[model samples]
Target chain A: MKDFPGTPGTLTGLMLRVGQFTFAAASIAFVATGVRFQEFTAFCYLIASMGLQVLWSLWLACLDAYAMLAPRDLRNPRLVSLFVVGDWVTATLSLAAACSSAGILVLYDRDLGNCKESVCQRYQFAIAMAFMSWVLIDISSLIMFWLLAAG
Target chain B: MKDFPGTPGTLTGLMLRVGQFTFAAASIAFVATGVRFQEFTAFCYLIASMGLQVLWSLWLACLDAYAMLAPRDLRNPRLVSLFVVGDWVTATLSLAAACSSAGILVLYDRDLGNCKESVCQRYQFAIAMAFMSWVLIDISSLIMFWLLAAG
Candidate 1:
């Protein structure tokens, strides 16, 4: 099998995990700061999704740190399988949540024209952050997927 | 690395690919049948996403079928890496589109309360199918990721 740059337990992998965690956490914080987010189911779902992502990414980051400090490589088949499943699930949920929230934001801005300047700007900022987080997760997910496939 | 089920080019993998294609096609069909879906950006995005999914899944299914018929292991690192990237990209798009469309559906059903029963049901079905497609793709993605890591 060809060696990949971001295999689990490596410094590259640790950095990717940290990126995922930071982006997801920031997305949640931005959305939470927005006023009246709970009024919409999509917004609530986005929070829930980002919360899950934060937890998952944090756990993996800790695991990556441990592996980096330890001697043994952590790219065993069973463990990588577990990581793949977790990453895919979280990635799916995060994308779904982000997209749904954006859809509603567009509706408010374009269709209803009800979003006044301040609140609408918050919504757009939150949604954009969520998308950024999703992009990070997607990249991580793809790397993990590649590692597993090459095995 | 221990052998895992649903490796690319296996029977299980073929079934998964077929499921992805079927659900994505069904989602597009349902949304296309619905009246006024073109008016919403979310719906249009959903259609485009599903269309991409159908093409990707179908291509993979054909590849799987050929591998099954031939004696090749079809677990080549390069090929699997390509599959991983394709699956992740399609999976991300599918989930985003589905979630956004679902958000609009929720807004119409709950907040605005303007959806007629029939149209609402159609919209709900289309979104549900889109979700189904995402689930299948997620499963396939997880399997592919595991295989690569194991290598």
Candidate 2:
């Protein structure tokens, strides 16, 4: 897959998965750290969405690590198909959650001026992290989608 | 694609593409009809995202129509890759915009009790349409991802 730099089961694959996991976890942490995020449905949804991303990325990262140790090509068509589907699903969910949360920030913090400066900063930070995670997820899905096709 | 009932150059594909276009357009129309949607960046983003979806889906629907009339396989790997990438990108953007807008609705209408009946209903309708569009997009992406892999 031209989109993906490392073949499956290699160190590159492991690193890619790890990057996904780390970003997702960081996004979740930043969002969770915000005070009273549970008060808003969008924030809660963001947490749930990022939580799913974290789990998915962690699972894949572990799989990649195992694959690395085994030194096996994780390019089996069926497995690739599974990976493609998983990546797409997670990518969709993550993007949705991040964007929705960002909307909230824009509405409350920017437009309405409801949030104070300090609180607004937190929201901004969390949403920024979420977007970062989303970028990673999108890249990963693009690669997986291509790999599934080309494999 | 097991999930997709239509072949690329068949009525099913044409129908699917039409479905995508209709839902995306509907989502955009509903959102656009809302009062003061542009006041919020999230709502504006929603409009932009849905607008893109409408264009992509409409374009693909036309291609599908052409393929049906011409009765070509439309299974070229490169073309399939392009379709896969396009579908995933739109899917990601649409889902994000929809979810973010929904988050605003939930926060303002449900949590804060800001919007009253008529306006709240409009927001709800728009968000629902957006969600409907997202479902179609997800299904299409899933099918395209699978097709690219299989092709």
CA shift of A19, model 1, Å: 2.9
Q: What is the lDDT of candidate 2?
A: 0.77
Clashing pairs in 2: A100-B100
**Regions of candidate 1 where Cα sits further than 4 Å from its true position:** A1-14, A59-83, A111-114, A141-151, B1-11, B62-78, B147-151
Cα misplacement distance, residue B61 of candidate 2 (Å): 2.4
Question: Which regions of candidate 2 fall more than 4 Å away from where they truly are?
Answer: A1-7, A70-82, A148-151, B1-7, B70-73, B77-82
Q: What is the TM-score of chain B in candidate 2?
A: 0.92
Interface RMSD of each: 2.6, 2.3
Tens-digit lDDT string for candidate 2 (B1-151):
3335654556776677787778777777777887887888888888898889888988888888887677666777678778878987887787778888888888888889878889788778877877887787777777777676665
lDDT of 1 by residue, B105-136 (tens): 99889977888999999989889999899889
Error of 2 at A23 (Å): 1.5
Error of 2 at A69 (Å): 2.7
lDDT of 1 at B147: 68
